[model samples]
Target chain A: MKAPGYIFAEALRNLIKKRATVLYPYREVEKIHLPDGFRGKIEFDRPKCIGCQMCFRVCPAKAIEIIEDERGKRPIFLIYRCIYCGQCAEVCPTKAITLGKVFENVALRKEELEVR
Target chain B: MSFEIPIGPQHPIHVEPLMLKLKVEGELIVDVDIDVSYIHRGIEKALELRSYPQGLFLAERICGICNCAHSLCYCLNIEQLLGKEAPPRAKYLRVIVEELSRVHSHLLWLGHYFHTLGFETLFMYFWRDRERVMDMLELMTGNRVTTSYNVIGGVRRDITPEIDSKLRRMIEHLRERMKYYEAAIRSEPSLLGRLQGVGLLKPEDAIRLGTVGPHLRASGVKHDVRLDDPYSGHEEIPFNVITYDTCDCYGRVMVRIGEVFESLDMIAYALDHLPSGEYRLKMPPFFKAPVGESLSRVEAPRGELIHYSISDGGTNPFRYRVRTPTLANLASVAAMLKSRGDYEVYIADVPAILGGIDPCICCTARVIITDEGKKTRRITTLTELERYARERGVRM
Candidate 1:
């Protein structure tokens, strides 16, 4: 019911219109616009944190670790295994931790990923 | 050995290992039995051991392709369970991301299906085109693939003006390109000849087997979770539920292809009317739930993904169950496989059927061992020869 020879001509019409991709990072440092729920790095309030291990225990890959001292409670994220699910920020008992829009850090080595 | 032929668990066709024992009389398959549950990591079981917010992240990893959908569904379920509702702006943003994901995921499946059929040019064309959708997703969510956007009350960040403008431009470019795909479909006689009248699953057969998503819609079923039970501002976004009455493999593929354009229309609608307000509502960490059960369903790219959660007045969930569409739709494959004769024909049909529901092997199959089952000598994905050695060790 259809002709086979016209495949190339049809595909050519599609290719000629040009893709709409803009080089994002290079687009001069205007205000960096983002959508809702963008997974940025983890942020902690420090004051509201209740020292419970809700966030550290719940992280699937053990990305978040609870480090304690005289300062009450502190949690460090190993960014290498952080799948960016934001579980640590969400499960924070005291509403002390939240994810912010700042996912710029990149490290080649595993040790550079430790938040502590 | 007995007259048994095991087809998968490690085969060229299957995306994951799921062995099927075929008792054959010469070339004719007399008896067939499936061996699923081979790829199980108990993702639902993993979720139960965590709190509500902790469970959200684990849910997204259930399938990499529909990660956004998983997070959205989980977030909505938790929102319902918490006696809270997402604001209109947050709800609209959820619709945009979900529709964008549907476009990206369907095109991904198209590339893999064409690759399975040995059509290299078409495979490249589909994958190349799919990158545009990925760019749109990247603009919305920082990451290209694992975009865990939804939180308890609303989304995490906000869609800025620049991203919205870019999305609008991309939508305009794609609207015209969709016409070319339609033209290609009209012109390719070979593809039509192969696809039409093949792998016919009648209207009744599709419903009886609990088939969902485009597969059910292909058989002329007017049911869509979005239409039947609207969630996350899908009630406000204006889009039609695309369906066809043909009930063949060709119908299924065509319906999905056309739906990509429909999703593009949805993205435009969402961006134009993008609302304002605080992006997210905060939820308490250790609040006790009302000790009840709730179910939420979303029509994922594959099918309806239903999450059933039971909570008590505790930090962790009492029970969690996930009913993936692929697992439910796989019940229909045994019937579809019987019609095709010869090994090659059946093997080719395997990808089409498995792909029809956009099968995610990681979500569908689960391996459990009540006993060793005699330790039958077999091979694995590791045994398959590869030019590039896998980089396996992970430590910190």
Candidate 2:
């Protein structure tokens, strides 16, 4: 049973099978599998945030910055600095921060990536 | 004439930054020297600046492939410092995720190993199957590679009934694929030619060189951190330690494949016997650890991973040290690369030998000064290194 080219048969059969990867950028966006609760880009809800500074304190990457505005204190998330570990979302008392499924975080400017 | 050839600071044989100074005579390798000083991220020092909760993320970043093991070891070390243990349910959940990551890591290594050995078909097949495990990881944990699943008190999230069923299905599929690949690898003569008797390390030599993980197990020595010092509820799970007596590259491949099967079985068993209770203990985010030193050992996919920390009753550790498995196995690599008597090593066999240890150079990067004139090498402290550079008139 120590025959050479043993895997060739399997490879031949695989020629008919559909490709494993999807054309994500061009088409087949729906074909790309993203599981529920998948950690990706950061989304901040300013209304729900109590400005407890818990997210700022617990964030491993120091991605959250608290700023004072007309609505008391609110956090501005530097999405570029976030590791997407979801620590901020877990520690948020008011459930203000959540990791959305939008993993395509490319942006030209630093200001564009900030989630205030 | 014996010529000195450099494999890397950058080379195609391995991906990570590593330099192997090989002295070759004709086709035979006579002497070898390894330098892994590149890509040192200073993570140990960074851990000291961050608090316990923040340091967990830093620890998980030590190695992308074995992030689960690193984070688990860090949590165990900090939990010991706090003198608190995770609940029963959390421990079983930890085991499930830990084993799943282990399976994924082994599969990645096997596929990458074959890819390096010029077996592209096997490589594609292996990685194609690996996607299933990655999907399972993403389903169970939030992310895929850097799971960050383990926290100081326990796991980040509880396993849902849907996830449990999905995990079982993945395990079943992986088990079948692994069996077929194992049989294929054994019967394929070309693959066997490159693997069998390629990198020979005797049991005594393996132990003497301080090798750990599958590389050590492949030498016919039965030493596993899980069996010897069970952590994260590994004591409750029953599984056999797989070892092969071939004492070569073939054994290394076989040992990893066997481990994948064992990990699947362990996951199945853990899911069946998972205890029901509160998955996570309620603990504050930032807390001071007591003044004590704690050490933790985890059997990472590659080998033994050690994390040691000293807390000075502060929010951050006073000092932290990580001993990655790749660093320990580097000594054995030097031993295997040198040609001696009837056990000849050629230049072509370098990749086969180096890939056998599953080298992660980024995790093992450290500095050492070697004197060419004196033919001596010594590790220097940071202050000493700075002073040496200053005295030599190099701009600081």
Question: Which candidate comes out best when scored by TM-score?
Answer: 2
Mind sharing the TM-score for model 1? 0.81
Which docking category, incorrect, acceptable, medium or high, applies to candidate 2? high
- Native-referenced Cα lDDT, model 2: 0.92
Q: Model 1 Cα displacement at B86 (Å)?
A: 1.0
Off by over 4 Å in 1: A10-61, A68-74, A86-112, B1-4, B23-31, B340-347, B366-369, B373-396
TM-score for candidate 2:
0.95
True contacts kept of each: 0.59, 0.87
Measured with C-alpha atoms, the lDDT of residue B313 in candidate 2 is 98
Task: Report how far residue B170 has shifted in candidate 2, in Å.
Answer: 0.9
Q: DockQ scores for all the models shown?
A: 0.37, 0.81
Model 2 misplaced stretches (Cα beyond 4 Å)? B369-396
> What DockQ score does model 1 reach against the true complex?
0.37
Across B1-396, the per-residue lDDT of candidate 2 in tens digits comes to: 989999999999879889899999999999998988878798998999999999999999999999999999999999999999999999999988888898988988999999999998988988999999899899889788999899998998899999999999998999989989998998999999999999899999999999999999999999999999998788899999999999999999999999999999999999999999998889998899999999999999988999999999999999999999999999999999998989999999999999999999999877788799999988777799789889999732
